[model samples]
Target: MTVKKGLKDAYSLKTPMDSVNLYRAWASTYDNDFAIKNDYRSPSEVVKYYSKYSKKTDTPILDVGAGTGLIGECLREQNSRKIDAIDISSEMLNLAKSKQVYSKFIEADLTKKLNIASSQYGAVLSSGTFTHGHVGPEVFDELVRILKPGGLFIVTIHTGVFHNQGFKQKLSQLGKCISPPVFHKVNAYGSKIDKKHGNDKVIITVFRKKMS
Candidate 1:
């Protein structure tokens, strides 16, 4: 496989297999080659809103699209609860496993019904998943389905996708099931060598499942 590792390759993904293959090869160097090199700040940004809005409870947390455990590492620092990870790439999950941040690492596609039970998580957090050529708002129903009543659902959606994609419409469709979403603009990367992507930004969407 021709392993072309760059933001363009990630942004150009058209299918789940594309993600699987790309990350499978890129997993080993993902942190350094892409994340650190670009001064990726999405994970920390997700954690910031999570810390501000979510209660530190024993109820398990699920990190969706948890590539390389970046979010998991941050969450581990804040809470020592049972945090589980779900991602499509086993290679990425393997790297995440080494961090020892997640109690469970699940390899599954978010485009399908996850093996997880409904209302099983107190909070579901994700970063860098809802972007161009990646999973879209289509998975929102399933993500929300896994959250316990009153549980928090926090994720970072690339600003462009949030507007251009169906995220706004999907959130409205889920309005009955969840509270009004709170969106926060966040820098997707800090000081970076990648000038083209240095200005990338995201909207950290935070909302809670309704307690009926």
Candidate 2:
């Protein structure tokens, strides 16, 4: 298939190499393409939820799957300045950097060991990263590892992913790693994209790591 076709068909790719290439191809247009087309608002939504329990404003927040800094934009709008972003795509990071949202940008894949020190961030957030063909709950191990005790974690996990990807089991195994986790039903993958999609569906989840 032509490269253009590959970019268009990115959602179907399940392999690691394809995931990297797909983001590489779509990075430049991502903010306008998927972000605008689907009315992507999960970034702002994630930040908004975390605001309910805003912690240290001076420490860094680790934005996983920060793709184009949609969440960073929201965080910045709220006057958050210590946010740092990490993504697998250098191209996407470049776009995010131009927005001047994140204090620092790290290029790292969620499926691999992130080159970040442990218990460093005061909070962690992500959106549109745990969907089909992307990173999964296994990344949470690293997330839990790096987050300081009492750090907040807000993530938007696709409902299908929550059930099918052993997230439940992982959460059970990870008990007390964080306070009792709660799932919130915030809109995701807009209806304009699929009228048949569950209008009642949502993917927002929020939690706070317990003091160790």
**lDDT (CA) per prediction:** 0.90, 0.78
Tens digit per residue, CA lDDT, model 1, 173-212: 9999999999999889888656787788999999999987
TM-score of each: 0.96, 0.90
Best by TM-score: 1
The best candidate in terms of lDDT? 1
Superposed by TM-score, candidate 2 places the C-alpha of residue 103 at a distance from the truth, in angstroms, of: 1.3
Regions of model 2 farther than 4 Å from truth: 1-8, 196-200
Cα deviation of 143 in candidate 1 (Å)?
A: 0.8
- lDDT computed for candidate 1: 0.90
Cα error, residue 84 of model 2, in Å, equals 0.7
